[model samples]
Target: MVDAKDLSLAPRLLPISLSVEAGQVVHLIGPNGSGKSTLLELLSGLEVPQSGSVWLQGQPVSGQTRYDLAQVRGYLMQQQRPAFVMVVFEYLNLVLDSVQLATGEIRDKAVADVVSRLAISDKLHRRIDSLSGGEWQRVRLAGVLLQVSKALNPHACLLLLDEPSTGLDVAQQAVIYQEITALAREQEIAIIMANHDLNRTLEHADTVVVLQQGRIVSLGPPKAVLTDRLLSDVFATPLEQVSTANGPVIMRASSS
Candidate 1:
């Protein structure tokens, strides 16, 4: 669980407050530079807030050191490019080291489990730089999951993802969303993610927070927060939510 109150990050983000509970999936959606990423950074303790406070499970994030916070939350940024030459398995060993988990069959099993879940089992021996965009996304996500597993209570860990579905294709994006939902339901890991795909957010998010001009415009269920009027007003264009067999789809309004 996480909470933020009276949060301000200058022109990028105005004062805002929000809370996330265990087994919940909260989505932050807004236009470019609308403070989605800034909010995540604040919650993850990657950046100290200019004002307000972020609490993890009850304790103030400010009191926690960077390493201390890492144990409670796993964050995957929007842009993650491999900087050095390392194979997938080797990369995972580094993650395990940071978490202070032991290496051996135990670590091997952990890495295997994550890659298997993300369906990247064959890429363990491949270099990070050689992976396709989707493959790289899965690999990075696997590292985040690995970190959560090493937590004192994996189920209590918070997952903060910034556009996690960035490089994945449609099917792969669905897979990642499904995995996130499963993590919340089965593992009780609270997840807060920022995404540009409204439909995906609608399908998987337990709650949606709509931000505009660095302030919250609406926050509620997809149906309540993503109405025709709200979408049109927030985005400064005519928009509508159409109910289809699949689910609610946000679309541009027909001119006619």
Candidate 2:
């Protein structure tokens, strides 16, 4: 549903090309300054690349097409700052207000579904400024999801998230990832997320794109691309992949 061809943004992002199809969860994994955020911005049409092109749903992603693209794509940046002090429900209502919903019932159902999935039902009455880091992140995410939900935008086909699990604890992270995977599968939406946790990517991502110094080192299924040798070289550390009952885990290679 989304295609980026030879995308480049000066020194930060090098030539990159990739495509995301419906019901696919593509993860971008790399260390600091590897251009994960740059790539996402390019795909979201938040920033135009110096070279190459990004297309969403077959339309070129430029300032001219952003208005139409906005209806079908949801993007959550790594950092979010609340613009004003408002109740969680109020903030969410404002997001839904932008979309053309069928009726009050439809709006209510959309809000309920996103809040429940993000586990922020209890925070509806709370002020945005009063929530903890994790709570705030979930609220931000809920807003994005609600804006592009099928009830609001039946044409919704793409979701771009950057470090979505920023401040959440382990349990919360697990819940969020599960919800994310379900969203992609059930809604048939193509998802591209920049994540730091290799194990989490392995568990949830249908495909993995490993980056290093602003270029793609490897791209494929997590188990195939995230091998011990590749990760060790890309991360510039001694790392190993171990087999466990749960799944394959990436860890620092023990020095003995």
Candidate 3:
């Protein structure tokens, strides 16, 4: 569980409050410079809020508590560039090495599970620096997922992701979201992800938090919060909600 209460970061982030329960997938949606990244950083303990507080599993998050938080949380930032020319497997092994697992077999199984979920099994032997942008993104995501997997941290209950599907194609994006859903529903890891893709948020998110100029405008189930007027107002564009077999889809309103 994660709780951010009245969080503020000066001009960039305002008093934002949110709580994510175990097994829930919450999406943060807003335009650029809407403070999604700032909120995530505050919750991840990467940055301390000027006002208010963030709590993880009942412990307050601060610079001093970050080390303890890392034991139960995993954060995937917006950008990741491999500096070294290590193979994917080697890089993943390094990540696993940082955590205390019960056995080598457990580490191997964790790696296999995350790599398969992200569809990166084939890239295991490839150089991390040489992989395509999407491949590298998936590799980084796998590393983060492995950190929170039961094999690494059984107490891992929070996963924070900022624009996680950055370089992937549509299908790969779907795969990533599917894995996110599985982590929440199956592993009971509370997930808070900042994303630009609204439709995907509608499909996958149990709750959506809409931000504007550093403050929360709406926070609720996706369908209720992502109404036509709300989407148009938040995005500063004319939009419409259309019904489909899958669910309601938000789209640009027709001029005609």
Candidate 4:
């Protein structure tokens, strides 16, 4: 469980209180510079809040050591550009071994499992510098997931992801979302993912929180919170919420 009370980060995030239980996926959506990333950072203990407090599992985050907090939370930032060169497999191995004290075979198996799951097995031996944007994003995501899976208590872990599907195409995005959903369901990992793709978030998230200018304009189930009024108001643009054969969709409104 993660509880944040009146979290404020000055100009980036306002005082916001949120509670997340295990086995849930909460999607954060908003335009650029809306404090989506700031909130995730506070929850992950990466940044200290100016006025608020965060509690992870039952202890205050301020009191927990960095390593102690890291053992229970995994964070994936939106951008990562490696300065040093390394093969994809080597990089992933480093991440898996960070919090995992397993045997070599067990660690190797864990790395291979996530590599295959993200469909980046082909690039395992490839140099990280050679990977395309999408490829690197997948490898980074795989590393984050592997780190969380190696947590001291997997069932109590939390995953904080920012635009996790930034460079993936449609098919790859689907696979990543599926894996994320499974992690929340099967492993009971509480996940907070910030994404701009409304359609995908609606499909996979259990709850949606829409923020604008560091304020939550709406929060609830995707269908209930993503109305035409809500989307248009927060986005400052015309959007139509339509009921489609597949499900509900938010579409850009045609010019009048």
The candidate scoring highest on lDDT is 3
Candidate achieving higher TM-score, 1 or 3: 3
Model 4 stretches with alpha carbons more than 4 Å out: 150-156
TM-score, cand. 1: 0.94
Q: Return the lDDT, model 4, position 31.
A: 96
Clashing pairs in 4: none
Q: Which ranges of candidate 2 are over 4 A from the true structure? A: none
List the candidates' TM-scores in order.
0.94, 0.96, 0.96, 0.95
Measured over all alpha carbons after superposition, the RMSD of each candidate to the real structure, in angstroms, is: 1.8, 1.3, 1.3, 1.6
TM-score, prediction 3: 0.96
Q: Per-residue lDDT for 1-256 in model 4, tens only? A: 8899999998999899999999889999999999999999889887888999998788888866667776788889987888899999889767756665455666677777888989999998999999999999999998888877733335347899999999999999998999899889988899999999999877888999999999887889998888888889888999987789998877999888
In angstroms, the error of model 1 at 77 is 0.7
Clashes of each: 0, 0, 0, 0
Against the true structure, candidate 2 reaches a TM-score of 0.96
Superposed model 3: Cα runs more than 4 Å off: none
Question: Which pairs in model 3 have colliding backbones?
Answer: none
